[model samples]
Target: MALSGELWADLSAERRIFCSVLLFSWTVYLWEAFLAHRQRRVYRTTTHVPQELGQIMDSETFEKSRLYQLDKSTFSFWSGLYSEVEGTMILLCGGIPFLWKLSGQISGHAGFGQEYEIVQSLVFLLLATLFSALTGLPWSLYNTFVIEEKHGFNQQTLGFFFKDAIKKFVVTQCILLPVTSLLLYIIKIGGDYFFIYAWLFTLVVSLVLVTIYADYIAPLFDKFIPLPEGELKQQIETMAKSIDFPLTKVYVVEGSKRSSHSNAYFYGFFKNKRIVLFDTLLEDYSSLNKEQTEGEDGENEETKSKTKNKKQGCKNEEVLAVLGHELGHWKLGHTVKNIIISQVLSFCLTVLSRRFEFQADAFAKELGKAKDLYSALIKLNKDNLGFPVSDWIFSMWHYSHPPLLERLQALKDAKQE
Candidate 1:
C-alpha cells in the first residue's frame, strides 16, 4: 500500500492525461476491429449469394464482390492496426513536443522570434501534416496500385499517380496554411469571446470552400466539361425547372482518369447551383466501355484472366433517376440540414440515422422515379462491386445511409403503392 501510494503520487497530471488519451484511442480501435472482424467473417463465409440478392447479383459477381470486400477488410485491419501503433509510439515518445521544438528551431533559423507564435504554429502544423502524408503514402499507393489495380478499378499510370499526389499535397498546403494562420490570428486577437470569433471564422471559411470547391478547386484536379446539348441535358434542365431549382449548369467531370467508380453530386448556393456528374455515370460517356489500360494491343493480362465485366454507367432515364434522388436532398433541405447538424455535433464517426436517406428516397418516388431508381441502385451496386451482406452491428454503426437491399426494397414497395 505504501509503494502503491508512492507510485500514484509520482504520476504527473500530464502523464495521466496522456495515458488516458492513449487508452481511449486504443479502446475505440479495438471496438472497431471487433465490428470489422464480424463483417469480414460474413464476407469470407458467405460464398453463395443470398436468395434476396440473386435477382441483382450473379454468382460470379457475388463471388467477386465477396472476395473484393474480404480483401478490403483485411487491408483495413492491418492499416488500422498500423495507424494505432504509430499513434501510440508517437505519443509514448513525445513526437508532438519534439516536432513542435523542431518547428520552433526552424522558425528561429528563418529569423522569426518566439513572439511570432502564429508563424511557429504554422511551421508546426505544416511539419505535422507533411509527416502524416509521408507515412500514409505507402498505404495509399498499395491501396491504389495493388488492391484497386488487381480489381480492375485503377486507371492511372505511375507517372500520373505521382503527379496527382504531388498536386494534391501542394493544393492542400495552399488552403490549409492560409486558413489555419487566419484562424490562429483570430483566436489570438479576440479579447474575451475568442471561441465565438473562431467559430464564426470557421463557418465563413466552410461556406466559402463549399461555394468555390466544385467550380474552382475541383476543376484544378479533374477535367470538367459541359454536359453538351442532348436529350440527357434537356431532361436534366426540365427536371430542375419542374422543382423550381435554380440550377445554373451541368458539368461532367472526368472521374475515369483515376478510377472506374461512378458518382454524381450538386454544389453551390441559392441561384448559382450547379450539378457535377462523373463521366463514368453516363452510359454513352463511360470509359469503362473501352478496354481498361494502355498498351493492351493484343489480349493482355486483364483480358486473358477475367471475363469482360458488366458495362458501367446508367441509361438516360436511370441517370435522371439518380439525379432525382440527389435533387431530392436539395429540395428537402437535407443538404443544408446536414451541414448545420455536422457543425453543431462532433461525432467520432459520421454515421447518422437513415431517416434523411429514406425521406430522400421517398421524395424521389414522389417525383415518379421509383422504377428507374430501383434499377439504377442495382446497377450502381454492381458497378461498385459493393458486398451486399453486412454484419448488422457494423452496418448500423458505420453506414450513413441504409443498405442497397433496403433501398431497393423501399423503392419496390413505393412502386407497388
Candidate 2:
C-alpha cells in the first residue's frame, strides 16, 4: 500500500530522531576515548623519570631534565587546548547518553501509545551502559598486560587480572544495581522533582563511600596489617609526632604480590587517620640501603659482590624524606584544598581535576623533605618509563589525576623557597 505524503513525513521524522540520538551518543563516546588516550600518553611520559630515579647515571642532570620536560609539557600553549578538548569530551560523554535515551523513550511513548516503550527505553539504557563497559575491558586488558608488561610494570598474571575484574563486577553490581533501580523508581514517581532529592542522596552516598573506602572497601582486594616493629615504624611515629600529625595506625599493604611498584598513602580523617606503606617499598628501601653501605669504599671485587647481593634496600634517610613529602601534602592543607577545589572545578570547568594535581605537588614540597622527594620521584619515573609520556600526561589530565613531573617540579620550586 502506498503511504500518504503526511504519513511519510511522520515516518521520516521518527527515523531522523532515532538516528540523530544514536549517532550523537556514539560520536561523543569516540571523542572522549580519543582524548583520554592522548592525555594518558602525556602523563605516562612525565612520570617515567620517577620510576628510574635509582638507575640514573647522574641524578642532578637527570632531575633537571625531568623538570624541564615537565615544565615544557605543562606550560605549552597547545597543552591547554588539548586539555580543554579532553575535558569537554568527558562531560559530553557522561551527559549525552542519558539525555538521548530519555528523549528517545519520550518520543517512542508518544509515537507508539504503549507503556512497554518505557521498558524498552530502560533496556536500551542498560544495553548502552553495558556495551560501553564491555568495549572498555579490552583496552584495560591491553594496558595492564601488553603496555604495562612491555614497560616492566605489569606483575599481574592474566588469571589475577580476570579474577580481579570478576570480583569488581560482582561488587559494583551489588552496590550500583539497587541504587540505580531505586533512583529510577523515584524518577518514575516524582518525575523532574526527583532530581533534587536524587542529587542530595548521591552527594551523601559519595561522602560515605570516601570515608569507608580505606577501611572497608580496600581490604576486599588487598591485605593490610600494622606497620611491623622496627626502626622504620619508630621513625614514622616520631615524624608524625614532630609534625603534630596524630597517627594511631600505620599499615603495610601487600602491594608487591600484585606488582613491583612501590607506593605509600595517607588515608582516613580524624581518629580514623592511618598511613599505608607498600611492602615492596619497605623491601626495596631496605635492600638499597644495604647496597650503599657495601659500596662505601668505592669499587672493589668484594664490595661489588656485596653490592650485587644487597639490591633490596633504600637508604633510611630516603624513606624518611619520602614520608616527609607525603606528610607535607596533609600538613600544608593540600588535601583539604584539593577536595574543595575538585568540587568547585567539577561544577565549573569539569576538567580542572588534573590541573589541581600540580597544585597538590607544589603543596607537598612546602611541607619539607624536598631532596628525598626528588630521589623518590626519580625512582618512580624510571620504573614507569615504558608508557609514553604524552599518554600519561593527557590521560591524568582527562580523568584520573596529574602528571608526576609537574608535581616533582612543584616540590623543587617549593624547596628552593
lDDT of 2 by residue, 344-412 (tens): 554333355455545445544555666666666656544433122445434443544444555555666
Root-mean-square deviation of Cα positions for candidate 1 versus the true structure, in angstroms: 3.6
Top lDDT model? 1
lDDT of 2: 0.59
Stretches > 4 Å off in candidate 2: 1-135, 188-192, 283-315, 332-367, 386-417
Tell me the whole-model lDDT of each prediction, alpha carbons only.
0.86, 0.59
TM-score versus the correct structure, for each prediction: 0.93, 0.62
Q: What tens-digit string does per-residue lDDT give for candidate 1 at 294-363?
A: 5444313322222245667999999999999999989989888887888764342245537678878888
Question: How many residue pairs collide in each prediction?
Answer: 0, 50
